[model samples]
Target: MNTPSAGTRWIQLGLGLIVMMTISSPQYVWTLFVKPFQATTGSGLPAVQVTFTLLIVLQTFFSPAQGWLIERFSAKGMIALGAALSGAGWAAASQIDSLYGLYATYGVLCGLGTGIVYVGIIGLMVRWFPERRGFAAGVVAAGYGMGAIATTFPISDMIAASGYRHALLVFGAILGVVGFIAALGLRPPQLGETPEIPADKVASAARDVPPKTMLKTPLFWLMFAMMAMMSTGGLMVVAQFAAFSKEFGVADALVFGFAALPFALTFDRVTNGLTRPFFGWVSDNVGRENTMAFAFALEACAIALLLAFRENAYAFALLSGVVFFAWGEIFSLFPSTLTDTFGTKHATTNYGFLYMAQGVGSLLGGPFAAMIHDAAGSWVPVFCIAIGLDLVTAALAWFVLKPARRAYLGVPVPAVPALAEPLAAKPLAA
Candidate 1:
């Protein structure tokens, strides 16, 4: 196959972003649907909450499967399948009256569909910008966060005007159309299509270690822990932010959910997405450790503000922006760090394992935060917990990450063995 032009590569990225973006809107906007769905079915809070919780549970399960598919098929194929399922799930969900059917279709099926698509999109972006992993991944990942910001308000309005079932059907149709079109545009870069490097350059980059050897290193564990901690805080925000704002002071908390959309998208696309590339570029020079340390520190300051102030809109906005921005960078930073510290041969699998750590962190964070709020009857404790974790993340980034990057860069040739132990078996390549 002929190599794709730079423009074609970018177009593929954009299309992948759009597809991923659509898959996310339903999940993020769940609160809007919850009340109406309850009324429509004459079901109580338990039923509605179960639907939401089940969706998340399904998401966690499907992530690994999604990663597997990306290796076997191209990003486009996986995404197209995912998109079709998601659309069909939502459509079926709209027609269902029983909560069980809702859980099976919307909760299980749609969640799995989105999970598969997410892995493909992230993998694709990392491959496309191998040299600028942070920025490229941020741009694609940001589409998820940003889309919530962009769609939630208009979606809320539609829900109010047309009722929840109708809103879902309309949205499902839109996702189907947009997702199908976008999926058509995805194509992987052929080998040698990537930028060229001379033989001497490759030799000079070699190291003493072998592939799969790096798994035994302390550096890998530290990076994994650091990723887990950083992700915990961000996932906490995504899971609880709407409920937090709604519970605290906002009269129309749902409206504020839409309101927060702007900051979510802008901070992700602009601060996180844009800054990620810049940070990754800087990592090439100043070092990944230093660049990530700065990002983690930035996150600490944001979390601190939330702990210090309670329910203040401005404080909430600032904290939310920081959370989104840093959250965007976490995945972006990991791929390059893995490629640099390990090697590109197993980059995708390594990334998948690393992402599993993130998923674990998120899974832990949601319930942990809920416990804190339930016991304390306020979000202050939750914020305090996040701040503490952010501090740990900062320290890990500064100490462990810095030294690892230094060692990686100092080596003339990073042997595949040196990379082996540090990486888990990775997902398939984008």
Candidate 2:
């Protein structure tokens, strides 16, 4: 089999992005339909929240299966199926009159579809762009976030013009068709069975550690914790931004929805893609520890601004940009950190396990924020919790990750890539 050239890899990246745009786009911009969905169904806030909570739960519940499915059918077949399920679920959801119907169709069926496609793109991108995994992963993942800017208005308009059910059917059909087309373009690298070259001239060594042994390592636990902390706060914001804005005195909820504009979405995509290479390379050169520590610190600051100074719209927008950047960058950096530490022999499976951390984090985060808001009448405590978690993560990254990267690189603590005085580490950015 002929290997895809670098240009072909870029094409795969575009297809992966399109899949993200079609299926994974709705999660962040869910706020757009909350009011309308509630109005149509006569449901309360908790009921509405439960629907989305159910969506996250179902999506997370199926993560392992999705990962396993990717390995079995490969990326193309699985994501094509995902696209069909997602579109069909949403379209069916639009016609539902009861909460239960919505739950099964939108929450479970659609969630399952999302899980399958979402796993495929990430695993596919990392394998395809072995030379630039972080940047490639970032570019693919950024589609999920940026997609909202394009879909939000149209989806909202569809709901308004044709009602929610029609909107769902239309969107679902479009997603299904597009997904099928893109799936045809998906293919794994054709590198045969050759092992990757080492990052240094010292020669690449393979890990003899079994999966169970690697899981038992303290580094695995720490990285899981890091991913969870970085994600929960961001997802909380994504899930609740509509309600949060209303509480914070923004009269127009659509303004918040429309904030998913080209500028905002482009910022999200560009920063996320840029940061992957920037920080991954930095992690390669400066050490994953220092890069993560810096990311954690920056994220903490962004959370602080959201909590303390969001009374102003401009301030909120500025902080939103920071939040998106941090969110995108953190997502990109962790995989690079993992592959750097663990090597790539079983990269897909290992990354899939770590990806479960995001699911756990989102599971805990979405409802927790709502429950807190129900109790406290503000997002203040939620923001505080996120900030505190980030600070602890920063400390952990500073100490634990630095040492782990050393062990993985087979170097002394003082000689870790980021810590070495001469800092002449190899560039993994490109």
Candidate 3:
């Protein structure tokens, strides 16, 4: 098999970015739809919110199977199928009259669709840029993180102008078509294709560890727990921000001449997008665990500040962006670290198992967080729980994840040299 030129790989990256961006609004812009759905269905907040949890759970829990399918089939075809499902899910959702219908359409269909494109593209990016795994992954992850920024206000306006149903139908078709067209152009790098990197920058793993072998490793499970914990904190904010903002009487307040909720949401999206690449680049040079520790700790602090001053609109908006900026890098850091540790041969499948942690996080972060707020009659306990989880995860990233990964790979602290080192030149075991 022939390896494509750098230019060709970059083009593939661009297409993956487009596909990711198109599908991302479904997740990120979901908060905007929550109130509308609840009003339309007359379901309480917790019941309406369960759809969000269902979406994430299905999207994440089925990723390993989705990854396996992508690996065994045409990447383009699988992505196209996913795009169709995602778009159709939204379109179908616009006509649903009940929560169960919403779950079937938006939760199950869109979840499965996004899962397929997400894992397939990440795997493709990892394969295409073996030497720049973090950056490549970050670039694509940014599309998912920030994609909704372009549409959030538009959807909000459409909901206000026409209705949620109309907004869903129009955007669903556009995103689906765009995603499908872009997916049609995606091609995974040929097997055994490797990018050239400096000898000192090779990853620690000497050979690809099959997914089965990776599943049994303590390193993988520890990383899974870490990912879940980090995910819970971030996702809690993502799914519940609008609710909290409303409860605090700041949702409609003005921040810098813009509505506080939309302004904060847009700002959060930008910071969220920027953090993926920024931290991914940082991880490439400084080390993944170090970057994780820094970003996670920053998130913990931001959450605490938000809880302290949340009633103030300006503080709420600013701190929300900070919280997201600190949180979003997990999307980039985890995948790069996983591929770095386990090898890229089975990256799509291996990351699938790890990605399930996001589903677990969603269960904890989405519905559970909402339930906590309801039970306590305040967002205070929710914020406190999130803060504690963030701090604990940050500590574990450095103290536990770092040392365990080093021992698993038999490398020293700060394992930068091994990633770019020539595969055949190293004596490390698979």
Candidate 4:
């Protein structure tokens, strides 16, 4: 394949963004279905949320293998298949009334489908814009984060007007067809096709590191630990936001003249989407560890403020957006940071392993958190725990991850942000 011109690469990014947008509704808009599913299935909140947990767990747990599949098959074909499956999962979900049926369709099938599209697109983006991996990844990640902005309010209204089933059937087929068409346009960059222009701020691995070696390193695990901690708090909010909001008395309350739940969701999606690219671009200039520290700290504070003022409906709505804004950048930050640590050669599979941190988090933050909430008789303890995790992870990013990466690279700890030092990864052992 010939080197795609600069414009051609932008076209590639745009296409990936569209495919990303299509799969996003499943994860982001799920809160809307929780009560409805519960009413129909006669299950408790925690049990219904098990469906959400399964969706994330299955999506992430199988990612390493999914990455391998994409590497073996064509990225475009696999991605299209993933999109089709995701759409079908939603459509299938529309017909089901039982908890187990949700487990099969909404949880298992949608998880697998979205996972492939997510991991596949990130893999391609890292290679396509190696120099701007952080920014590129963030843009597409933003698509996933923000994709539901177009759907949340409408889906909420549809459920009110018609029903969840009607809403699911219409949107499922639409998102599936759109994602499939866009995925068809995507392809991996040929060797020497992508630019190698590296700024001092945006670092790259000196050489491509395979998944086995990447897994064995303390540095990778450190990143994983930090990501897992961060993911726990973020995933908790995403999966349980509606539940907690209703308990706080903001779900049906009006905020800015719209129902607080859907309004906050729409606003949260915007901030969530915007943060990915904004932080990704910032990381491209400042440094990944530096960026993580700032964002994570902001997240800790956002959570505390959210809970302290939960009784005021406007505060609940607005502060929830603050929480998401601080939380969502991990999608872009971690993948770019991984490609920078390991090489882009196995970016997909390497990220697949790291992405499992999210699965770990979904377990902790999803059903487990809900169980905790039920046992504790309030959401206060859950929010407090999430706050603590955010602060600890933020400290690790600057003090721990910074020094760890520098030591792994065998570079002296400069007074500067350590990982930002020039990196020349050692070649893989023969």
Candidate 5:
């Protein structure tokens, strides 16, 4: 095979971002399907919400194995398979008559499909952009966050027009096809493509640490806890935005001639997508921990204010957008930080373990939050709990994650061993 040029990585990055975008609507716009699902099955809120939880839970919980499979095979092949499955899952969901079938099709198939593309893309980016890991990870993750923007209004309109089944069947196929086409160009980095850093260097903390060893570190567990909390607040909003909007009496209210629910969802998608790359770029220069503190603190404040201004359609629309802005950065921040600490060789599988936090979060944020709402007849307690998680996780990032990562990386390289050598080692770039 010919040597991969330096500029080729950019092309790969673009393709990865496209794939991420294609897989995104299944997760991001799921709230749009919640009510339709409930009406069709005559199921209650908590029960309907289980589909959302299972989608995320399966996506995240099985990711370690998915990552390993991607690593062992070709990213291009795995992604194509994943895209097909995800798209078909949605289309199949259009024909399902019962709740269990929804769990198997929309929940299980979509979850596993998206999980492969997600983990595969993240790993591919880190390998290709060793020097700009934060930016690379952020950009692809931004695609996932932002992708639903293109579908939110259309799907809402579709459901209003022909019903949810037609919407799911049509758009599901579109998303899958687009992702499959984009993934044709994606694969592992060429041997000489990634620059190498000395394991002992304090500035460039690059070493190929395996997944098994990484799991034993206290540092890794701290990250898991922090990620779980951050994922909780954001996911609660994603899965329940429509539910709470109706409950708070803002769903049908107008905020610039658009219904508040779809409008808020649209705005939230934009901010959520933009924050990943923006914060990732900032972290590249100012440092990751500081960015985490600032972003997490903002998320906590935004959530608190969103609840306070919940009654006002304008506040609900805008503040909810701000809430997402702060929350979405975790996708970029955690992956980059993990790569910084654990090394690039096993970025996919290691992040898979960390990504399970999102599954933990989906449970806490989805059915559990809905159960709280059904019992209390309010969303206030759920918001309060989410706020608490954001605040505590933010503090942990500033006080715990930052120092722990630094101290752990500070250890002498001689104490550590590489799981596998770089494909080709070269001196670090200045």
Candidate 6:
């Protein structure tokens, strides 16, 4: 296969973004459907919420197999199949009357579909933009993080007007079609080829490290632990935001003339999307561990404040956005960092293992957190656990991840090259 030009690679990136955006709403807009599903099915909160856990678990845990499939099959074909499954999942759920039906359709099918699109796109981005893995991954990840902003209110309104069934059918078809078309446009970078970069550009890794080798590294496991910790907190919020908002007595309150819940969800999506690229760019310049520590610490603070002042409508909205902003960077940070450390030869499959941390996180954050709230009669203990995880993860990023990566790289810490530096004839292996 011929190498794609920079322009062509960027166009592919744009297509990946659209694919990601279309598939994102299933995960992000789920909270909006919780109450409606509960009312319709007459299920308890815990039983109804298990679908969310199932959604995240299958989405993440199956990613490695999905990633391996992408490597062995046609990227376009796999993505098309994924899109179809994702759309059909939601559309089929509209007809289901039982929780098991939901688990079969929305939980299983949507999870598998989203996982395929996510892994495929992230893999494509790192290959196309090895010189700026963080930024490239961030741009696509932003699509997933921010995609729901455009649909949250619309879904809410639809659920209110036509009921959740109609909303699911309409949006599911739209997402499936759009995602299918976009997936057709995606192409992987040529094997054994790297994008040309300036000689002075900061190289992420000296050479490619196979997935097996990467798994053997202690650094990978440490990063995994940190990612799981971070994911637990953010996902707890994502899965339970609506419940907590109502619990705090601010779900119906107004913020800036808009209902607080939707307003916060929208605002959180924006900050969530923005932080990926913002911190990705920062990491490309400042270093990964430094960025991780900063973002995680910010999340720790935000979650604490959110718990403390959640009853206040304004504080609830603002602090929720802050928490997401800090937390969402993990999507960009961990993937880029993994590729940076392990190299991109098996990025899709390698990152798949790491992505399972999110599955672990979903288990901890979703049903487990909900169970905690039920037992405690408060969200306070859950929030405290998240805060503690954040602070500990932040510390590990600096003290553990930083030194570990350097030792693995066998180099002293080095500064990123300035943009003014001349372009190199050969590209970096990362």
- Name the 10 consecutive residues with the lowest summed lDDT in model 4: 421-430
- Candidate 5, poorest ten consecutive residues by summed lDDT: 420-429
Where does candidate 1 have its weakest 10-residue lDDT segment?
Answer: 419-428
Q: What's the distance in Å from true for residue 64, model 4?
A: 0.7
**Per-prediction RMSD in angstroms?**
6.2, 4.7, 3.4, 3.0, 5.7, 3.8
- Candidate 2: pairs in clash: 94-165, 286-418
lDDT ranking from best candidate downward: 4, 3, 6, 5, 2, 1
Pairs that collide in candidate 4 are 206-425
lDDT of 5 at 384: 88
lDDT of 2 at 337: 62
lDDT of 6 by residue, 113-150 (tens): 99998988898898888777789899999999888878
Candidate 3 clashes between residue pairs 3 or more apart in a chain or in different chains:
201-420, 202-418, 202-419, 202-420, 202-421, 203-418, 203-419, 203-420
TM-score of every model? Answer: 0.80, 0.84, 0.89, 0.90, 0.86, 0.89
Better of 2 and 4 by TM-score: 4
Give the C-alpha miss distance for residue 293 in model 2, angstroms: 1.4
Question: In order, what lDDT does every prediction score?
Answer: 0.66, 0.68, 0.86, 0.87, 0.83, 0.85
Using lDDT, give the best candidate's number: 4
Clashing pairs in 5: none
lDDT of 2 at 114: 80
Judged by whole-model lDDT over C-alpha atoms, candidate 4 comes out at: 0.87
What is candidate 2's lDDT per residue for 1-430, written digit by digit as tens? 3345547777888998898878765465566667877887788867876777677766655665676677766668888888788878887887887777777888887788887777677777766655556666667666765666667778888878987777777877887788778877887776652224335412112453334656888877889888887778667775566567657764242334554333444454456545654565455445556767887788789879877866665566567667666666766677666665565555555666777788878877777888988899778888888788878888888887766655654555563444422222232221
What pairs collide in candidate 6? 199-424
TM-score: model 1 vs. ground truth: 0.80
Count clashing residue pairs per candidate. 30, 2, 8, 1, 0, 1
- Model 6: number of clashes? 1
What order do you get sorting by TM-score, best first? 4, 3, 6, 5, 2, 1
- For candidate 4, the TM-score is 0.90
